[model samples]
Target: MKEINREVEAILRDMIEQRVRAMISGEATSNDLLGILLETNIRESQEGGIKNAMTTEDVIDECKLFYIAGHETTTVSLTWALILLSMHPEWQERAREEVLNLFGASKPDYDGLSQLKIVTMIMHEVMRLYPPVNFTERSAAAEVKLGEVTYPPGVHFLLPHIFLHRNPETWGPNANEFNPERFAQGVAKASVHGAFLPFSGGPRVCIGQNFAMLEAKLCLARILQHFRFELSPAYAHAPYTLVTMQPQFGAQIIIRRC
Candidate 1:
């Protein structure tokens, strides 16, 4: 396990370095986020004070973080989405119909994907039921008080998102049930008690949320366009956590061409 971890870390480090090298060699186009980050770092280093300027190591660290966090969260969420859609064939058919109606036989574009209300609703429901990250930890820089609880400096707080998401007080009696209609009026109307936090919430929310959503929508749309799927007979329902909540065994689904 340790050897595997080291190999993973080494691969990640190489990827970060490759991007940095690409940016330096005038090979990477200044269009994507990586290019933008590289440009910003260079501009800041040239124009700002030492405190404001970011070192090469800082850029690599940020890139590695963005790559891993963005990739992991989205992959887990999409996997769960597929599993849920397979279990609920009716919702899956409805989503496919919606996608077909919007972009039939054509590539799903940004504007069209944004207009997919039903698909968005299903995605929200899946996220609520199976959030990628089970919990989040935040350390207090200084002493802080919230209501009756007082926290000292260097205190680490564990905010369990799954607990809040599944709470009956927050989501009514059908909190644990798969009901996309809860988000019918939109996310704002879904939870009035600040309960719906699939992306963590507030300023500390996942930074690549928009990117992840777009990625999921496009992948799901493409999947729906060409295939119909359902859980396999051998499939087991076991969700466990490592860095993220994932299928402990595996998510086995049978797919057929639509």
Candidate 2:
């Protein structure tokens, strides 16, 4: 792990250096996240002195977090959503019909995307079933108690959200089943409080949660507008977690133009 992290840091350091040089030379202006971050850093340095700005190491760390949390998590989520949609054609059809009703072959716009109730429900259900991150850990800020247990400050707790998501007691009899209708009312009323946490919960929840959902909805709508898809004969059902939950074997899907 140390070796892999060192290698990744080296690559990120090189990228950061190149971007810094570009900014210094005025060769190009970037509008991407990295660019915005660099711009902010420069502004801070100019206004509040160098100590107020993030160091290159800080930028590299932020980039690493965003790359993994933003990219990997969403990619795996889309894959799972597609795989689940293939398995449940009825739901897929419903989602497609909803998308068509709103956009009607036009590119999905911001307002239209918000009106995609079925697609949103489908994405929520997919996350519930195969959440990108299987578990998240948190350290107690101060001494805290839950039920009969008490923990000291800095006590780390591993919350296995996968198990919680599928709890029959919390989600009812069909908890393990694919039922997006459960979320029709909305996430708050979907299940008990803290029951459906694909992106985790609380103030420290995944920062990209909203953006990721929006991206997923838009991507799914576009795909539905263009194609009908299903699981291939060779597809296997084996979800495992490396960093995020993904199919142990690749997801093989058969897609045809709409």
Candidate 3:
């Protein structure tokens, strides 16, 4: 792990150096996240001196975080969405019909995507069944008490959202089943409050939650516009967690152009 991290840092460092040189030479202006971060750091240094600006190491750390946290989570979520949709052709047809009605074969737009009620429900249902981050952790800042138990400061708690999302008490007997209709009224009314957190709740919830949903919606919509798909006989049903929940044997599906 350390060796891999070192390699990644080396590549990021090289990229950052090139961008910094370009900015310094006035060769180009960047508006992307990296460029914006570097520009902000430069502005800070100019205004408050180097002492107040993010160091090169700090910038590298931010870049590494964006690369890891922003990439795999969404990729796996899309994978699961495709797998589930293929397994349920009725839902797949419903989603595809909605997509066709909204935008036909043209590229999906922000307004059209937002108006995708069926697609939105499908994505929400997918996340509920196969949440990318199955669990999240938190540490007690001070002593705390539950209904009957008390915990001391510094204690850690691992909250498994997958079980919560599937609990019969909150989601009824069909909790384990895939049903996008549950989300027809939206996530808040999908089940009991706090029971449907594909993105963990509270102030520190995943920052990429909205971005991830938007990205999945757009991609899924576009795919539906161009193809019809079904699960392959070679596909397996194993879901395991590495960094996030993923199909153990990979998602294999047969696709035909529309």
lDDT of 1 by residue, 1-258 (tens): 899767766775676567767767878555877678767776676787677777666766676688678998898888998999999899999999999999998999999999988889988888888888888899999999979999999999998888988999889999999988899999889977777777887788888888788899899999999999999989898988888889888899999999
Model 3 Cα lDDT, one tens digit per residue, 106-156 = 999998888999999999999999999899888999999978999999999
The order by descending TM-score is 3, 2, 1
Clashes in predicted model 2: 0
| Pick by TM-score: 1 or 3, better one | 3
Give lDDT: candidate 1, residue 70: 90
Which model, 1 or 2, shows the larger lDDT?
A: 2
Each candidate: what lDDT? 0.86, 0.92, 0.91
Clashes of each: 0, 0, 0
Sort order, lDDT high to low: 2, 3, 1
Candidate 2, residues 158-249, lDDT tens digits: the string is 99988999999989999999999999999989868678888887887898898999999999999999999999999989999999999999
Error of 2 at 58 (Å): 1.0
Candidate 1 regions exceeding 4 Å error are: 1-30
Better of 1 and 3 by lDDT: 3
lDDT of 2 at 3: 100
Q: Between which residue pairs do clashes occur in model 3?
A: none
Model 2 spans with C-alpha error above 4 angstroms? 1-4, 141-143
Q: Candidate 3, which segments miss by more than 4 Å at Cα?
A: 146-148
Alpha carbon deviation, residue 66, candidate 2 (Å): 0.3
